[model samples]
Target: MAKLIVENGGPLYGEVQISGAKNAVLPLMAATLLTEEKCVIDGVPDLADVKVMKGMLENFGATVVDDGNGLLEITASQIRTVNGDRKLVTEMRASTVAMGPLLARCGKVVMPLPGGCAIGKRPIDLHLKGFRALGATVIEDDENEQVIVTAGPKGLVGDAIYLDFPSVGATENILMASTMAAGTTIIENAAKEPEIVDLANQLNKMGAKIKGAGTDTIRVTGVERMGGSIHSVIPDRIETGTFMLAAAITRGEILVKNALPGHVRPIIAKLKECGVEVETVDDGIYVNARDKELIATNIKTLPYPGFPTDIQSPFMAFLTTVKGKSEVKETVFENRFMHVNELNRMGADITIENRIAYIPGGKTLHGAKVRATDLRAGAAMVLAGLAAEGKTEVSEIYHIERGYEKFVEKFTGLGALLTRVDED
Candidate 1:
């Protein structure tokens, strides 16, 4: 296990570079299975999840090479097997993404149930529904807890599919599966996140005809084949938002490089509402919180173009020292407030009722040993630790490493007194 030790009351005052979006790159990696040619991706983040995805691709007879300069070359000339490693597939929720391409390529796929953070029950029923709608037979092996998807002898035939909820994972799975289907596929109520748009753009580059990505409705016209192409991943909007809040929480000034300001407009508006100054600079965004007192603000997590659910935790951590009460409502994940208890341990006044959290600000937080429940929660703990009065130790840092690349290095570059400690 690894833990992070953070010293308190240091204002981060330097430039920090944002990495590629984990959510975007994962689906893009799975998309490589759609072609037999080499697919080269640039600006891919070096994270634990990326490494896991690389290993999974290798198991399926694909060659993935990292150039150590933010470039990944992938080629899936032939698929050696339809069965994936049970342990690896079960360890990452993104592993389920492979099922779509495998079914399209091999007419069948058998994989164990996917798993990741224990935030809540993220059922893949929507994904299975979309698969079934596309003329594939889905079977549940209850005894083994595995899902089996097989295409008929005629292969997949496209149809009109409507999702009960606009799940990002389901949308990605169905969209990828439809690329090589027999006919046109219309997806209603699809996810409109920027990551979804990025995936659609990449698929288009690979010769798949996809349109209306950043909207509720998506249309995919199936092609006979797809070819690989070079593409660059988008910057991590969630990481950018986290750094912006880190500045506000510690009364710091930071310039976030390679940031897409339009993607984080909601967060920037919220920070400005809390009395933080944000400006758009060339190729980056600069945030200043020096000599500023944060004010409590109400926030509600929604889909893109609204406040992002991934950033709610770190934003909540910043609100702890505000002079008034703040209300935070989480509309995405059910168990996202798992960090409330951990934050309370650090002398924060927070009470959660159902999906809503009421935070009475102005509490002076002191250092305490806290465990990171999930990825975003781990970020919240780090932000709280940066503003607390004493030294704080954050355990279970593997969750943090799954998404963020060079987390400690980036924070240290921004003048944060944080270090990683190995516990054997």
Candidate 2:
């Protein structure tokens, strides 16, 4: 086990470059399975989940090479099977993304139920519903926890389908599978995230006709085959948000490079409401929280163009030091408030009622031992540690390392005195 030992309440001041979107890279890696040629992907973040996905692709016969500087060159030209290693697939939730490419290339795919952070129950019913609409026979073996799918009539004939919600994973899965289908497919209520648009751009470059990607409705025209090419993923908005909150919590100044200010508009608006100064330049965002007392603000986690659920926990940490009261309602997942208990350990005045958390701010927090319940929650703890008055020991630092790149180094660069200690 690993623990983060933080000396609290240090002003963060530096310029940090953001990495590529973790969410974007996972789906893009799955896209490599669409063709048998070499596909080079740039701006890939080094994370545990990425490593798991790479291992999964390698096990399924794809040759992968990483340049260690956010670039990956993958070739799936000689795939041996559509079935992925059950153990590897079960280790990461994004493993389910391979369903589309495998089904498109091999006409059959067998993968175990994917695994990820223990935030909430992320159902795959929407993904299955979309595949079934594309003429695929889906079978679920709950006894062994596997989803085995085989091609249906004419090998995945595309059709119109509607989603109850704009699920990001479902949208990407359907888009990839429909590329090789016989006809055009229209998806309504699709997720409009930048990552989805990145996927559409990559697919279109590979000869897939996808329009209206950054909107709720998307259209994909099937092609007989897809060819490979080089693609670059956009910067991670979630990582940008975390750093934005880091600046606010410590009353510091930070210039986050390569962050798309438009992608984080909702968060930016809320930050302005909380008395943080924000400025958007050509390729970076400058945040200054000096001499500002953060005010309480309410947040509701929705899909893209709205506040992201992944950043909610870190926002909660910011609220811990603010003056007045705030309410956070999480609509995306039922159990997303897992971080509340951990935050409370750090002397946070937070109360959870179902999915709603009411926080009264202006509390002088003295850090204590805390455990990270999930990935984002782990980040929340780090933020809280930076603003606390005393030492903070956060366990399960792996969750934090899984998403953020060189987290300790970034915080340290921003004047945070923290150490990653190996615990016995």
Error of model 1, residue 213, in angstroms? 0.4
Q: Which digits, one per residue and each the tens of the lDDT, describe model 1 over residues 134-175?
A: 899999998998999998778999999999889899999999
Q: Please give the distance, in angstroms, between residue 399's alpha carbon in candidate 2 and its true position after superposition.
A: 1.1
Report the alpha-carbon TM-score of model 2 versus the true structure.
0.98
Worst lDDT 10-window in candidate 2: 82-91
**TM-score of each predicted structure versus truth:** 0.99, 0.98
Could you tell me the lDDT of residue 376 within candidate 1?
A: 92
**How much is 88 displaced in model 2, in angstroms?**
1.6
**Worst window of 10 by summed lDDT in candidate 1:** 6-15
